[model samples]
Target: MPIEKFAPISRAACIGGGVIGGGWVARFLLAGIDVRLFDPHPDAERIVAEVLANAERAYGLLTSAPLPRRGRLSFCASVAEAVEGAQWVQESVPERLDLKRRVLAEIDAAAPAEALIGSSTSGLKPTDLQEGLTHPGRLFVAHPYNPVYLLPLVEIVGGAQTVPATVERAKAVLDAIGMKGVVIAREIEAFVGDRLLEALWREALWLIKDDICDVETLDDVIRYSFGLRWAQMGLFQTYRIAGGEAGMRHFLAQFGPCLQWPWTKLTDVVDLDDTLVEKIGAQSDAQAAGLSIRELERIRDENLVGIVQALKAGQSGEGWGAGKLLKEFEQRLWAQAGHTAPPVDMKAPLELVETRVSPAWIDYNGHMTEHRYLQVFGDATDALLRRIGVDLAYVEGGHSYYTVETHLRHLDEAKLGEGLVCTTQILATDEKRLHVFHRLHAGPERREIATGEHMLLHVDTSAGRATPAAAQVLSALDAIAAAHAGLERPAAAGRAIGHKARLATPA
Candidate 1:
């Protein structure tokens, strides 16, 4: 299962733009945000470009259809300009409390009051991170795992000062950026992901230090068993199924006997001896040997993508997934549209129009007004997007365009009932922008009536800014125009394409 540009993030700001920060920036950009980077460190541009390239590839693995083009990323001279009107500011400075405080202060000062400021602090609580902010209520801990572009979980926890509205808005932002965020009801140290992983880290060190097994062996033990299940469905949910209809109570009763046993012990901490540390670290390196970090990262991302898709498909251990819910959404829309099937020629192009006059077009003398000619050309532009792409399906993915500029020239006008026809021509296109020229003609007379020029920019709905069209779709548009070029342009009302992916899998 897959989702293509599930939601959109139009504009975002990333404060640190280092490895992790750069990853965060890439994730936002790929989801169609015009992200601003505010890092002062050197090599910032190099890191961001690298991360962006990797993110595009990772996003490709998640879906087969064309993904929206990577949004433009700019390196701002200061944090203030980078975050001034941003809807979301992701602060990823070094985890020192003092540094975090300074960054938060700057964001709170510069960002819009309605904007949400979140820190990517792994273990820092909201109070710790927002200690010096002007309005700490809008600040919260939004800890995302490493390699954020591929992994999708972000743990959100807030302090006493945090407002629930801000937290909910942050969650909506996360959804638009295609990430899962779990909001912790109460602020806690270490947050959820670290707390869950800490238990495993302690036990893994014990086996290596006690000479029971090597690091590779211990990792394999869990990866072969628990890792597979955890990927598709978490442990608690898995146990619910294990208990049958009796649920948690039955599972607890069955496992209660082992509570007193030493199988599980959280009170003990294993000290890492120097020799053992060297041995395991080198072995771990050996296990990961011969591959560059980039290569390893690609492999890891591919695996995660496959696992996540499986979970979404309900074919993995999780018996139910998002695909089922989405089918209902599709079915609901289909029902609303009625069972009556649209004509197969709904996408057919009319060769010509015999009549184009309307009551609104008539003046006192029943002659068509000059403005009506331009109106026909304007309608032609709408016909083009639906023909090329950006139909209902693309719009649902938050991929639509707005005309920023237009120029019209009217050559002739006819009587109220006179015939008029129109033709559209593709002017030019790039990753994020499109330009077109349209013509309206006096039908059968073979005389030009009106022509207009237009320039449009793709937009992301969530952040309310321009972004680029998806790659595969841009290519499809090119192919479509090439096919129709030099052929008589036809009327489009009877020829609109439906808003649905031809073959894209749904999640």
Candidate 2:
């Protein structure tokens, strides 16, 4: 097996400033890659700016990894100027074959020979996309989902002239920027993910056309049902688990016969005739009520972030599917933040986590609830682990730290939207044990609101026994412990839960 290495590209060029193109610009810029964009439309710059703003907000809620400084976004006057020195060039013009070929040819002519040229076509074949190009081998389909910055899936398709190296290079770029690059074995129009999407969409249109369900009802049918499952495990794995003890083979045996049933309307697409179009459009308008397209997009992005983060919270072992993808993306964020098990300021505790309280953390009393404090502390602990080199990959290797005990002291309340920071001080450390204290402060004045003392045990997960941590992790822990040895012990440490000393002598 050939191991794939990640190759980071520092600069990217985006041609076309429509929705997909704008999203590409945002993804590249947020990944710390400078972007040179070329789009003749008058509103191109404005559209890209809006997309970038939305991406930044959505990503802020998605992860806390220290992100690199913002990469510069330059709007170039011509395609040649945009791809002049770009390490990667992406063409995201309208879904017209002739237009794409012209734009791609222009990009291929200007981009450096080593630079990979990717088309953001939803369904166009790569062979068609590469036609009339000088270096067709460098061109491939790198289709991404909408709001590309948050979604990690990218379908990579290679044409007849495209070599394995070109496909690998595209994969490297996608992986480096925190995406799941799934290569199609053969070139096909619409690729894989979109084909599945189209099937569902076609079925949905037919159902709505036949008045079987309205827009809101149909959306509810999915969102309130299998949509949740698809966000994590996906269809096959979900059905496999539904097979119970018999597993996938049993599932196929049970449901295999249904494949021949004429139950699905996916065999044909519904014509969008005037009457059907009006009905669908009216139903959609009613579903939207008064929300603008931008508002709707915001809601969609927010929900996606929350759902994906929920999946991330469920990751364990070698996390599968979307949960695994979320974990990997977060790891990339941490790595970009420059966090490592290295010597730091020995004089004071390390401030590991900083975030503002979200509305979801607020309770009926209008302040952050008790359990929210624990969530923050947990995030802080995860940050501490990451700093000590106990990241996702490390834990996946069969070594991890499990919290054996915890004591939380809620001295004050944290209000919604208040800035909170968690400073961690290592109290004690040994080969297999770690003792740490965390202080959670709120607001600009750093008013102390909560504190947590924890005892964690390093365990060899594969052996199901406590074990000494890796040398690098131990060194990092010991360094922090040594630095804090001179500081006064926290009064909250080692405290038992008792209101006061009771006068038990009378009893």
Candidate 3:
């Protein structure tokens, strides 16, 4: 099913607020779904708060697309209270089977009849977890990776008693929240992802025990080699590229015999005695370079943001893999924000974009950098274009407005976390030309901080020449132009830079 068809749930219940549960909370809340959390841990509130903060920071750097308002978070005293009125109930308790079954039973009795129950078990089968539950049909395993808010994949595994509709609903709900849910064919311990990971993990442990490589060296081997290829293309596809003129079939024919090699001892379990444990622990600590867990988490998130953004710009700006999901998610957000042009005031410029200065936008000097200013103006331009019916579909239809010229004047500095608003004025427009001016304001007082004047030319992307826009776009532009015809023109409109030489003052 297409991701855009999915509808976001209104509320969710999170049981057991550990790292995984907190991540689930952050994901739901950021997607604008209210959350009721029940965790007996003394530091549950603090842990969730930190996770949410990190998630928010990563999101700010992840995309320039407008996001929905964050949903409210409430801490409940019991599982029954948390599951009340919740359409989705997630159990992220410990990995023990008995503990998970007990929690699932409590949740099944309290959660709404229509609520879909999910467990964050890494290896336990859904059928085993569903045991002792009143509504086993609605329960399934939704295993997610660490730092769940940033990693988008979720494994959806159904049990023997789980209904088919439950898996479908789980996938749809995950899509609505900007997640990629892959339903397993059948219930199995550790499912797909963990199985793949465990193989490499066992091999790495054996290598360390044999004194072949340290933790940092092993990590470098992955991150600097196949990991990069895997980031954009998975294992099979990477091998396909290795085939050169041929593809996967030829590559497999040439290297398939290597599978019988004795290079890996997958079946041999390593004895993790105290000496081995201490050795691995010391090496791992050295690899960390004394950085705290939170500090390392922030670094990881920033790097992930960069990778995701780079992928989002791939495939000619359409996005690739998880980046493709992000593009669709952003489109949904724009739709929810009401892209249609609203009633024009006829006396003032239209407010098109509202955002805050993200942490990534700051420079070493602690002020928003020069390029970020251009990014904000560009976002404002995109917003204005969308308002006039020039959206993704419009561009895909073969025509778009390209900014031919732009002049920007900066009046003040924009610091991190400061609110920004960009108002656009339709100075003039024709079938093939659009002249607009944008004023950027900062903070609650709405002080003007910058101005951008631009001339955009409508062009047929396929033909590579100027062309008239579609009838719908032209009509929208004409209406807005007529309304603003009587309005005063901006003083900065049509201004050009000029330089004058001055003699130095006499000392």
TM-score for each prediction? 0.63, 0.80, 0.84
Of the two candidates 1 and 3, the one with more favorable TM-score, higher being better, is 3
RMSD of candidate 2 to the truth, in angstroms, is: 4.8
After best superposition, candidate 1 residue 220: deviation in angstroms?
1.1
The models' CA-based lDDT, in order, is 0.70, 0.84, 0.88
Better of 2 and 3 by TM-score: 3
Candidate 2 local Cα displacement, residue 43, angstroms: 2.9
Among these predictions, the greatest lDDT belongs to 3
Output the lDDT of residue 187, model 2: 83
Name the TM-score of candidate 2.
0.80
- Report per-prediction Cα RMSD to one decimal: 18.5, 4.8, 4.4
Rank list by lDDT? 3, 2, 1
What are the per-residue Cα lDDT tens digits for candidate 3 across 353-447?
77777656678998888887778888888887887888877888899999999999888998876778888888999999999988989988999
Clashes of 3: 0
* Cα deviation of 260, candidate 1, in Å: 2.0
In candidate 2, which residue pairs clash? 123-190
Candidate 1: segments with Cα more than 4 A from true spot: 1-9, 315-507
